[model samples]
Target chain A: MAETVLSSGEKIFILHGIDADFRNDGRRRCEYRSMEIETKLMPQTHGSARLHIGNTDILVGIKVELDIPHADKPNEGKLEFFVDCSATATPAFEGKGGDDLATEISNVLIAAYQTRNAFDLKTLCILPHKKCWKIYVDVLILQCGGNLFDAVGIAVKAALNSTEIPKITAATLDGGEPDIELSDDCIQLDTSNYPIIITLCKIGDNYIVDPTLEEEVCSTSSIVMSVLPNGKISSVVKLGCGSIQFNTFTKMLQMGEIIGLKLNKTLMDVLKEENQFGRQRRIFGFLK
Target chain B: MPVDQRRINGPEVSVPYHIYSDFNKKSDKVKHDFSKRSDKRIDSEIRKIFLKTGIVSQAKGSAYIEMGNTKVVCSVFDPRELSNKNGYCMQGEIYCEFKFAPFSCQKRKIHQQNAEEKQYSLILQRALEPAVCLHEFPNFQVDVYVMVLDNAGSSLAAAIMAASTALANAGVPMFGLVTASTIGIYGNHYLMDPTDTEEAICNTQPDNEDDFNHGIITLASLPQHNQISEVFLIGSIDTNTIKQATEILTAANKDICPVLQQCLVKTIMKLHNEKK
Candidate 1:
């Protein structure tokens, strides 16, 4: 999260700009900032992606391990989200200062992926009740300009798209205990149903998507929604310390649904196009 | 040598006995009768509520509420100077702690707050922040603690209502009183103020691909101001359900406002009589 102290004049200027459907960066109300996405950059992780939107930057890495399934959910695998706000993102985030924001973002992600339609955990299950694959999605906030949730959401989906889960070659029950063997073959996950988040910041009488840091300071409240590719909303959370009329809240939900579907379609297309290049594509690290 | 000696510890891999019991296999899986609940309440009918104020003497203000089986007690303390190492702020802050007793739920809760409890605390703080007049108590912080003695369903909504009353009881200035309600949506049925069982069922993924909406929504609103303070929705639900759920929840909030106002009035009357 980025923090800024604005004077009365500056606040009014930004508010008026939003009211007239023009943001500080000249983008329309619903238009998002152009994002740059790179996948499979880190060799240590099973899947890795970096996304940059305006000044906000997020890096997502996914690690998969074999573990026992939960007692209640024996047939399903687990998806755990852990967010680490690096000190480089902001000085205030140093030394456990960002725990609250980290928890909130991770909780939202967990709720977004909770539904089976969004991301099926059954596909990750190796053996029912005995063994399963635990996919750990770790998000690192390298920089925070504004709209951290949406940036992280995009990065996570891209990373999951590039993930290659090692396929099981053989399995058998030996002496009432399950024994499994792994092959060199790997299978890609079905990321088509993955959900992406859309954040709408209510400024003045209008709502804007992907507000910058200065614009975020002028807003009263914002809504963060996770929408699947099928246009179904998985979860919605209202953020900030302000309230809005019930009428405006419903309007925001509808707007978010439309924007989320467009963003999901665009992101999937981008990932698919990138995948077509295969391993021949040059990897882009932090360097230009 | 690394073990903690302060308290007793259970086995490393202790499984609940109910998991092994055969009694729950068949009977528990029986599809619930959507027509009538176990308590014979209709789908749209909420459970009876009992609201009271000034329950705790040690705190500045307190309130206790019960909705069917869920019981929650909330207390608010006087504003204290901000203790964190932050710069001067224009608006005061509110610190909310939401806790559940070990025996509050069917499964025993731990001493420390879990992830779900932490999320609930954050939501509770956000829901109450908009209703409070923080500018009046600038440079200070008000602490609110909510304890769930028994959780049957809609505990978060219950906590929100109780905390709002506690804040009002402490004479915190506000634009309007805050009221909250929860709903469980399953396909076409909207179960207002769902019980623990119904809430679980609604939150799960649909067994068949009927494309029906399902989810749980918890909303807090300021009735007099015509504003929604917080909305926490979980599960895959469509926009239509959200539109309908909000309307129903808004009406539910309005209905409970009068009950809260009456309780507050009674508390004030007793205080005035005692002063005489």
Candidate 2:
């Protein structure tokens, strides 16, 4: 990506403002822009969600398929994540141009879900060594304005929360041949307590919660932290070319832990309240 | 399309309102029994149709079509130049991607263009070929991305409807409004706008895989001139049944033309109203 040059005076002004704990947009250090979340937006996916955080828009769809487990992990289920940085996000992402970013973000997801506490691989199991449910989480990037890691993580959690799985009625095996029957009624899984991601951007002397594109350009380094319901850190990824001091890294970790706890609680509350409100809640998706 | 008379074992198979199958043999059996005309529908009957536009505002043109429970959404993009050298075609191009949302049916599958979606794209290209003025832009291509929100039945037909509406919404020059719908025969009865369930019932029987031979007729028309652009039939429909289904589809499109044109006019008016 080509860099946009800023006048020396403008750079100095922004740097000075940051030093004084003020942003050009008049937002405080920890404040975030308004966001919108819509669940079950794409009817085709078992669970789908669309989230817009500022100018960054992310859509995540969770598809469930039955598959035979790997030889090494026959008893445990599997989770795979694929990210597509669509051209709609920016002209620069046209064609295969978005592959690099897609890989980077998906790697972050892999790390986040790698830990056992973050996602229970056993919950996706169907049969001991025969069949297991594989969830393919496909994230489609529609737009980008910055702080994408936090937005994408939040959207993935929401999409997983809204996912509904078909109830398997019976699975019979005769002579090592299996026949599967599905129940007529559908069942929804509880994902309200799913993991939440807290991306801490190390700015001048402080670590900001979420950074806009401009703020991202100014930051030297950032850490993306994924936290599960029990306050356990699932994954922590450091980004940017700037080196981080040991003291700053520890401080950022503390900040992430505090923020992650609050984020998980708030997300659960919102999802529960929305579910309790049910269909009466006005449906707002892409149209809105 | 003639439904391959296959067993209805898939959890997605439905038989409540609409039945799927080739209608010739079943209609023949029903006709032999003579229990008054099945369906009690008029010769010019049409399935219940509903359309929603501006559903995907991010796209330049978008529309959603629902024929009974069969629902499809299409997004239209470009007269823009092809970004890739290999992705271009001579007579203007129509790049279509169709996918069934994992939750759209009983079994949730990964997101990819499946064999079924590929088949539909070819059929849709055939249906819209005559209606679209592809010669206008020789090197440019129009991409249509259709996602099946629900798979009750007739998704291709609904996709056709959605695509046409999206083109109009995009202000693409067209001869006129194009609407496509499917009609089928079950036993001795001719059913209009069969749902996925109805489609299944039409395509099945108690014993064998007879529904595979069931005939399905899909008709796309300009509706104003009574000119048919595409008429597809699967299974075996004798000359008379074909004529009957064609007449039914043609007349239904004829009736819907004004309504469809009125929608276009209303949308245009809204655009102008906003400008003013």
- Across B1-276, the per-residue lDDT of candidate 1 in tens digits comes to 012334646655545566557446635544667888888898878888899998999999999999999999999999999865777877999999999988898678766787888899999999999999999989899999999999999999999999999999999888778899999988788999998888888887666563657789999999988899999999888887898899999989998899889989999999899999
TM-score of each: 0.97, 0.50
Alpha-carbon DockQ of candidate 2? 0.01
lDDT of 2 by residue, A134-223 (tens): 889999999888888888888898888888878889987868876788886667765643567778887777778777777777775677
Once fitted onto the true fold, the runs of candidate 1 whose alpha carbons sit more than 4 angstroms away are B1-9, B22-30
Off by over 4 Å in 2: A1-5, B1-276
lDDT of each: 0.89, 0.68
TM-score of 2: 0.50
Q: In order of the candidates, what TM-score does chain B achieve?
A: 0.93, 0.77
**Fnat score for model 2:** 0.00
Q: Tell me the RMSD of model 2 versus the true structure.
A: 23.2
On residues A1-288, what C-alpha lDDT tens digit does candidate 1 reach at each position? 556878989999998888888878899899999999999999999999999999899999999999988876778998899999989999879897888899989989998988887888888888888889999999999999999999999999999999999999876778878899998989999998888988999988889999889888888789989998888888998899999899999999999999999899999899989989999899988885
- Identify the leading candidate in terms of lDDT: 1
